[model samples]
Target: MIASSNWKRNFFTIWTGQAFSQFSSSVLQFAIVWYLTDKTGSAMVLSVAMMMGFLPQGILGLFVGVFIDRYSRKRIMMISDSFIAVASFIMVIAGWMGILSTEVILVVLLLRSIGSAFHNPCLQAVTPQIVPSDQLTRCSGYSQAVESVSQILSPAVAAVLYRSWSLSGIVFLDVIGAFIAVFTLGITVIPELHQDENRGKVQVLREAKEGFQILRSNKGMLGLVLIGSLYTLALMPTSALFPLMSMSYFNGTSMNASIVEVVFSVGLLFGSLLLARWGGTKNRVYTIIGSFLLMSFSLFVSGVLPPSGFYVFVICSWLMGVSGPFYWGAYTPLLQSNFEAKYLGRVLSLASSIRLLSGPIGLAASGVLAEKYGVEKWFLIAGGLVLVAAFLCIMISTVRNCDNR
Candidate 1:
């Protein structure tokens, strides 16, 4: 169990703050993407902006994780949130003045994401410090659930606000939301400080050198990171390609795009719920494999599995949702259960950085290929590759015995 004070000040407050920030960020993301696409109608611009936004997280994250471990997690989060708020404030003001260019917006998104890269490892590391090991899975599930709630609300809210209000209005709300998160965070204090031996070292290079040494020696942990990375890289195309596919093969309407998003959110929500209730107690490794296989199999349709009907699409969506909980419940709990606290931030960031870095490539390439051949073929190809990876993962003794630690 978490200490009462820690639970009140750290977990509850931090989670709530992050959730608020995430909600606003979600809307901000929608605004930016919507604005870029609506204004430019240039896929190339969207691709560039997105690449700038994500590139920093992938490139800078592991080192930032080292900083998070070396310094105070709470401080990291507070400062990063503050900076992002200011950045958003500037963007909103510039937008209102009719001076916000795509380049300006791209720069703003990249800066905000840099802040997120710092914020993520600190947040990941801080959780285990506040919550008990046994409760970690439930806590993670709850955290995901809260974020899912934000996600559920963000798009719908953005759509309404965009119609009733304006894109600048949406960004202004995001700025307010980020500031509110900072205000909430200001009230919370971490009970205990986690000290890193690397912190006292005179040279930053020395500490980084040692951090790398520690990371390189852990084979089991390395295996898990690789699994997460490879799986994410292989399977991420389907979701990234969803909008294009919906536009191409489905009803060819904005509603179809929204349906894909709504289905994804529903899947995420249900998956989070399953993780919350069960917490992945039995053969967690096997469950991950099963989850991956199911998702792959569901996507491995020839032309389209939805059979050209709304009901059929809904069923496919629901089944796709089924894969999420199995993977996440098992995956998250396993990592938090076994890894030592001091290394958690670095390891988590390392994995996250690598996993996310590949996304833009997939997103852009999928878009291009869909335009070239067709989305159905993209699905078949991406899905087939995912299934092959799943088969390999299940067959590998190291992957199968992942939970042995």
Candidate 2:
């Protein structure tokens, strides 16, 4: 019955738009990794691309948070899509002429990352505006489903295209997805974004400062932020290592790497489907804790499991995906529901800033670890650390008591 509701249609349109964009990027993302690996035979190159792609987005998040709150969220997203499309078009052209060196890839990643600085906030801000507070979990769950669907398909397609076509073809397809995103935004009439009434009176610095003030005043939110930040430190290593894991653990095979990634993505899709059907528990903090525990186990399991078998690696990879939605569904809305509407963007951005710092450290560290001790050892070490951190959080009565508020 809920599936036939009007809100479903609107949410579907937005998610569909985001799906295509993610699909294109996912494909392009893997393609870059694959291309770099083949050309340079270096894990560091992949690390650089992955870190640069995330670092800029993280760095600009604070400033962008203020801007997004001040401006139209929908327009910001539309413009971001346009910028991404143009940058992708440039990449396509450059690749066509055989100019896809490491430097070019780095520049492309940098440009797209800058565009994403705006895109991330716009997307998060729009969700609370469109979806009722009661349905936020379902809304987020459905979005993750579509996103996972894209993730499962996009990289596999890119892998095939890389073997058959050239980088130009892959880039062109990516541009198409980006443009489709723009078209979707163009057709959808955006709702008015909510802001605090007192927002007009506050200076920008004070407004930004308000996020910190809220964090300090609200013990629950503050604890959640610190807890989530530590959890991110655990998770980042896996994100950085997926590419290397494929090569090192799977006998240095490209196809094997793709399969591992797709399986993980499908696991994410399966998790989202479950969340959409049942929704998450109202005890959001408990739900989050449960997910983190599962993630810790999955991370641990992945390390010891034989990396050669397709099924075992897939299962391990899926475990990572399964933990994702519960964490995201609980975390994102916690901030939105708890904070003043005027300060949501700034708060979310601050969250973004904290989480993003985990990227470079994780990527660089994991890459180095993999090179020295092997990827399997790296997984075990990282997973063990996650378990310790999660255990610490659960034991802390302060963190355990944090709620949406």
Best by lDDT: 2
* TM-score of candidate 2 against the unseen true structure: 0.88
Global lDDT of each model? 0.71, 0.76
Residues 1-405, candidate 2: write the lDDT tens digits: 122355566666777888888888888887888888889998678767877888898888867777777777778898998898788778777766877678988888899999998898778877776667778877778888888887777766886899998777888878888888888877765666555554465476766676667667877677777777667776787776786777777675767776777777888988888888877887677778778778878877778877555467677788888888888877787777777656667778877887787666666677678888888877787777667666765787766666644
Structure candidate 1, residue pairs in collision: none
Q: Give per-residue lDDT, candidate 2, residue 258.
A: 68
**Candidate 1 has what TM-score?**
0.90
- The digit string of per-residue lDDT tens for model 1 on 18-117 reads 7878898898787778888898999789878777877899888757767776676777888888888887777778877889888888888888889889
In the order shown, what is each candidate's alpha-carbon RMSD? 2.7, 3.4
**Candidate 2 least-lDDT 10 residues:** 1-10
Off by over 4 Å in 2: 1-6, 95-100, 194-206, 243-256, 305-314
TM, every model: 0.90, 0.88
